[model samples]
Target chain A: MTELEIIRLYRSGQQEKAFNLIVENYSERLYWHVRRFVCSHEDTDDLLQEIFVKVWKHLPSFRGDSRLYTWLYRIATNETLNFLHKEKIRASLKFERLSVEMEEKIDDDPYFNGDELQKELLKAIQRLPEKQRIVFTMRYFEDLSYEDLSEILDTSVGALKASYHFAAKKIRTELKKSSIQL
Target chain B: MGKDILDDLKRNPYSVPDGYFDRLKGRLNEIAVSSVDTVPRSLWQRIRPYAALAACFAASFLIGNAILRKTAPGASSSDQFYKELMYSDLIPVTQPYAIFEMEDEEEMETSDEDIINFLIETGVSVELIAYVELLED
Candidate 1:
């Protein structure tokens, strides 16, 4: 179903049908977007489901002010930021707990393949400030226009361009230092 | 610099490992079955500001009512008026008191009794009081 029809179905209380339609429509696209930011398949799985849950809850308030995809993108961006922030706070609050969680993931997480280069790239992305990472991911991976990034980030187009430039430069340098070719 | 970097990054494609989407879909279906009724945090965030604003308005109205009871005219004006009335009789006499001819004895007697009681309570003697009793013709 088209996004508009799915939205209509959801509003009319056909939640299951609407949800299935949304999954069929955007699951691949959202997975790739989320996977770019969080390399671990386990983390991306959690984030992807969380993103859809967010979309379902917020669909009623969608005024069609922007395209449906833009709205979804905005939610995905915010959820990723919040996830990172919470992870950072958790790490600060209890370093041991953070390490334990990492160890548990490393030991038993079925979704994590432990690809060295992809893991390094994600670690470098995480090292970036939130705005730079967002700009970088949206620009490089999602191939979003600067205008769309500006709308999603609530930043001026010029600033987003600058942020993306700096992020790319940093990522390239980091990759070179690690002796990994892009 | 921005254009150059953007173009280069565009040339580099970031790919998810195989089956990521399928796994994500499976996870979503699991969540839907497990907790189908729960709303997301982002939706609640959008409405939170309005809830806060309503709470502020309710608090302001209650506080205004409390202030009104303490300072509005009905609460303080009557007490102020009674105090002013009590002090009005203390003003000094500057001129001769106005007198009119009396016409009845019974009313005069009541008035005289009232004056005697006033004097006894206030420590004024009958000699210090001025009498204006009406004589019956």
Candidate 2:
């Protein structure tokens, strides 16, 4: 279903039907988006559920000021950042580095079928500050345009471009430092 | 990096368990259609972490104060007495009764009623204060 059709269905009081459609249409895409933030399948699964629950809760208040997909991406982005922040705090409380823990999770994940280079690239991505990491992942991996990123992140297009530029540079430097060829 | 190599790497390497999407769809649909909200934390659940953190800070402050009292110059007999009480099996380590035991006699004039009132004013539950009072008894 198109975004308009779903929104119409929701506004027409067929809220459950609209939500189911939203889940059907967006879940797989969102699952991958969230999976990139948290490497573990388990964490991704939990986060996806939470994200959808949030979507459902706030759907009534959705003003359609932006494209539905962009709005959805905004929710996913905020949820991912919040989850990461909470995890970071929890790790710090235990005197552990969240990045180190995430790298270990990536290494030990059975479902990660990436080659050595891909794995190293993912680890380097994890080393980034959280917002930069998300920008890079969305831009580089998901191939989202800067305009879309600007909408989702509420940043200016110019700022988003700079963030992506710096993120890519840092990833390249990190990969080179680890002696991994581009 | 060339666009070709980056595009090649764009192929997602992650995999989910077999039939996971189908299961997830059904689960999410149920959640969406259900009247009960499933995700936001309850007020207590949200507050629990900060509460526990504050409790930890309070405990640490009391323990550190006890240690400082024991090591400070011209330690009093009361400080020694509390130190012995802390080390001995008489009072549980968790019971922070020494918080009320001040080094200066003037500060010692601060009564338990005043302390309990301060704790109540500071948002401590009556149950906890009553438990502490019971410990004092």
Candidate 3:
């Protein structure tokens, strides 16, 4: 279904139908986007449900100023970041490092089916600061352009470029420290 | 650079359980329909946690003051008592009010009320909040 049709259905008060269509179209993509941030399928699943609930509740106020998927990305990014932030606090309360815990989660993640190098890459990526890690995942895994990232992150394109560069360099440094070849 | 193995490991290494998306729509719809008529929380509801914390602090401080008045040997004047309390070994310098300083990097934009509301809304138990408060004490 086209974006216009969805918006029209929403406006016409056929919101549930429009929303189901949206869930069908965007749930998997959004799932992948969120899963890359969280690195746990269970967390991703719970967070995805919350994200879609937010989207449903707030859909009435959506003014169509941006493309629907960009708006959806924006919501997904914010919710995932918020979840991570809370997770960080929870970890701190237990005197645990959030990055270490997340890397451990990646290591034990049953859904993860990568080779040794890919697993190490994910661990290195998890060690990055939150925003930089999200930027790296969205750029490298999801293949989103800087413009899309800028819109979703509400960051300047220049800043996003610099963040991605520093993130890549940091990941390489971490990989080298682990003696992972090239 | 050995052709940058980062570029070589390009395929996404994640998978979901079978038919996860197939069930997601129905699950979300159930939540949405049930929650559609739920009113937004009032401001008072949002700030109740912080207000409770403040009330607890005030009550505890007053009780401590009263106990000090009855028990301290030479804490005659309220001013003198406060002066000693400020300088006394009773309250450690490191632990005082530091837990309340929760303005971390991620929470700079969030208001205190919002944080309290978020904690409560996320099912942080009253005992945990009190435990955090006890940590503050």
Candidate 4:
């Protein structure tokens, strides 16, 4: 089913049908979207499930002002940021660096099949400030348009562009510092 | 940094367990049922914070009143006492009690009756005042 049909089915009280269509259509997309931010497949799976649960609960309140997919994207983004923030706090309470934990998760993940260069790129991405990292993920990995990002991030297109530029620069600088060529 | 690399980055490098999407809808069905089961529990969770705030408000109200009522008997609260209250970490709030300070003592006096009247005017029940009075007596 198309996205609109799913919303229609949901609004008409065919919640189970609507939700199944949603998962079938968008689950993999969202799983990949979440996975870029959190490198571990296990954590990505956990977050993807949480995102769908939130979508189920809050889908009724969706105002249809923007594309339905963009709304879903916004929810995924918010949940990912919140999850990272909580992890930061938890790690800090234990005197741990969140980036160090992330790098370790990347290393320990059996699901990862990328080469060393890809891993280095991921480490560079993780070292970024949270907002910059998110902007970069949405732009670089998801290939979302700046207008779509503005709608989801509630920021202006110019600001999103600047954030992306800074994120790319920082990642490139970090890569060079670590003797990893792009 | 090239367009080709950016395109490559857009391709997802992550994978999930086999049959993950096939099983998700069923898991969500269980979630829907479980969410329904936890409705009453969630309602309590929603109510918990306001309930705690009410408890804190009531405790502070009683404690503040008690402290005011027993300010070293016959030591007539000085201007410094209320000043300390204003500057102290505790009770930075503006209240009827602040008006009853020693600066106004000569004009109005900080007697138990004045405190009772103040507390009553500020919404403390007269019954509570009489109960505290009985305790004092």
Tens-digit lDDT track of model 4 for A33-130: 88888888878778887898998899789877888899989899899989999999999999999999999888888877776767777888888988
Name the runs in model 3 displaced over 4 angstroms: A176-182, B36-137
Candidate 1 lDDT (Cα, 0 to 1): 0.68
DockQ metric, candidate 1 = 0.09
All candidates: TM-score? 0.54, 0.67, 0.68, 0.67
**lDDT per residue, candidate 2, A1-182, as tens digits?**
89999999999999999999999999999999999999989988999889898899899999889999999999998998899999999999999999999999999999999887788889989998767888899999888998999999998998888888898888777766664453
Root mean square deviation (Cα) for candidate 2: 19.7
Which regions in candidate 1 have their CA more than 4 angstroms from the true location?
A: A9-13, A95-120, A180-182, B1-20, B26-137
Across A1-182, the per-residue lDDT of candidate 3 in tens digits comes to 89889989889988878888888889889999999888899999899989998898799889998889899999999999999999999999999999999989998999888888788889888888877998899999999999999989999999999999999998777767665453
Best candidate according to DockQ: 2
Model 2 misplacement above 4 A = A177-182, B1-7, B36-137
Tens digits of per-residue lDDT, candidate 4, B8-102, equal 44455556677876776567556555665664667779899999999999999999988878775345467666566555656435664753453
Interface Cα RMSD per model, in Å?
Answer: 5.6, 1.5, 1.7, 2.5
lDDT of 2 at B32: 67
Candidate 4: deviation at residue B120, Å?
Answer: 61
- Write down the worst ten-residue block by lDDT for model 1 chain A: A98-107
| Model 3 whole-model lDDT (C-alpha atoms) | 0.85
DockQ, 0 to 1 scale, candidate 3: 0.37
DockQ in order? 0.09, 0.41, 0.37, 0.22
